[model samples]
Target chain A: MENNKIKIEFLSYSENEYIARGFVSVFASTFNPSVSWLSDVKTAVSEGVTNCIVHAYPNEIGKIILELEVNNNYLHINIYDFGVGIDNVNKAIEPFYTSKPNEERSGMGFTIMQSFMDDVKIESALNKGTSIFMCKKLLNSVEE
Target chain B: MDIKYTVSNNNLTVFVYGELDECSASQAKNILDRIINDNLNSQKVIFNLSGISFMDSTGIGLLIGRYKKLIKHNVPSYIAGATPATEKVIKLCGLYNIMPKY
Candidate 1:
């Protein structure tokens, strides 16, 4: 795989959370990140993927598309879910803000993703879907 | 993930064997809840994460949920045996700060 650009589609089920976590962890391996750096990446990816499974479809299984790319020592990840879109992006990313409080959600999904990744971007349209784009800089310096 | 626990001298230490995430959160929560309910004399809880190959925010939620329940029972709790990876997740979420480690 040149440049290590990859894409995958999977069912939006909680069980697939492991697949999502493992996929990104393996993709981030090319950067030779530290254990801590890898944990950050994995956690960020989990939050993004979990959000889609738990909230986007709301119990109904749907499709989640994941796109990943490696740029030097940097990794860029995009998780897309074509289900119920966020009504307010601003409020959604706030800490301690969750739509499903009954589920005992800590409302830290986006916060965790943004904290672990170097950059996080969200785009969503009501009744359409949401896309989470996150990037993380690996600890190991790029080898020339 | 399989969850097993050992109780000694009214103190409980729960060991998590495998990934802890949304899929396993329900089972973990149920198991933990039962332990907490049954161990009325338990003084503390120590959650071991060393065997957990993977963890996420849901893991944190599970920890926090259980911790809160213990608080009501006056049974303090802490986390232990977290590997470098699991420890990173716990520390990053500020959960380690909330619950002391042994």
Candidate 2:
């Protein structure tokens, strides 16, 4: 499955959160991910896509890009947007450190991504945008 | 998200089916709040999350919001049938401290 890769680009809307989760779930299903693992990836993908709809493009809408790659025993995910980039990446990842506390944001977006994925990396530039890279290992895929 | 609740013997049981994330958080909170309020006499509230296929931070926010309201009305709440991944998120957020899982 080293050559299987899918990329999706969509508008930044809360409605697309479900689409992202559904699409990723279907894409990862080829690897025979477990129920818990599938759910974890869906949840993480939802948060990443939602962050773009909420924080990245608060004033205006923008394009959100999602890339999925399955190689060896891992599924790699990359979500990035072209909107307002996070100013402080470190503080943003801290639990309960929501920039929009008034919005009922539990500030667990990054935390969830970190907890669910085997590895997570975030990169952002001021006024540019944010990109999240995550990977999950498929534990039960039988060899071809 | 779809929310269905049952009231019996002064207990309110809510069954949520669908994804609970930023997309559905507000809607879930509103629907659940109304149901819980309509059953003000409920002494205990139990939330069934097994039907939920996915959840994110907003899930925790929704649960915490409901727990706070339940507290104001003197109702003890419990979480039941959370999926393995969903339960991991809940436990990581320390929700088990407030609402025990059954």
Candidate 3:
């Protein structure tokens, strides 16, 4: 509900690239983070968004909602989807584990999120849905 | 990310271009795994990373995995063309101590 919070929803399709690029850039610039940090954030968001497209819906159709909130010290990115939830959250974070090996997935989505973000948390059940909450802190700037 | 592999004589050359973040790390691993399994008898494996701009901890994992596989086959591993960013990560992970970097 704050002025710094941003919310957008889009279909979980390959064309989400444009949507992702726009949202990530706005959030990165708003926080005055370095370009390198922005790139990492963008890459992590891409991985999470792509996972929603490829894993969440499967053969069905669905939508993904991205919520971003930025304050002076931290930036939060939340991705949500209403699809078949992950059955094994632990195994899913393994470096080389992939449920869709036939699709050539490397199963590194969650790993990327963990490595790039300051904090990552996943909540879901078998048939409910999945939500990924990530937060990154800005270290350089302070309130004037 | 674009991945290309070339085998000549007894060396396996892997050229990884673009970014090798967590998203593309597994794809790189799978491609390398396939190449190594089918050609386990090679004398050496060379990773050409001149075109790589950015790499994270996952990149380190991939390199170490391949290095181990090559070692088991008695094949030495070599790397070249690492950008500053890539070099910093490699050093942070202490990979240069494990294998030769060019």
Which of the numbered candidates is closest to the native, going by highest lDDT? 2
lDDT of 1 at A9: 98
DockQ of each: 0.65, 0.73, 0.12
- How do all models score by TM-score? 0.92, 0.92, 0.65
Model 1, range A1-144, lDDT digits (tens) per residue? 336789899998888988888888787776567777878888888889888988899968999999999876678899999999999999999987889877767788898898888999999988689999898765755333
> Candidate 3 lDDT, tens digit per residue, A1-144?
124888889887755744675688886785577766776677668767777776788887688999988765778899998988889888877765778765444466687778778999998887677899998876464333
Please give the CA lDDT of all the candidate structures: 0.85, 0.88, 0.75
lDDT of 3 by residue, B2-98 (tens): 8888899877888899767545777888888988888788888888998886565557667877887789878888888787656755654567877
- Residue-level error in angstroms, candidate 2, position A93: 0.7
- Candidate ranking under lDDT, highest first, comes to 2, 1, 3
Estimate, for each residue in B1-102, the C-alpha lDDT of model 2 and write its tens digit: 799988888889999998888778888988998998898789899999989877888899889888888999899999999988889889888888899996
Q: After superposition, how far is residue B39 of candidate 2 from its true place, in Å?
A: 2.3
Report the error of model 1 at residue A50, Å: 0.3
Which run of 10 residues does model 1 chain A get worst, by summed lDDT? A135-144
Per-residue lDDT tens digits of candidate 2, residues A51-137? 899999999989999999988778899999989999999999998788987676778889889988899999999789999999988
Tell me the spans in candidate 2 whose CA falls farther than 4 Å from its real position.
A140-144
Which 10-residue window in model 3 chain A sums to the lowest lDDT? A135-144
> lDDT by residue for model 1 over B12-97, one digit each (tens)?
99899998888889998998788778885788889988899888878888898898888887888999999987777677678877
Q: List the residue pairs that clash in candidate 1.
A: none
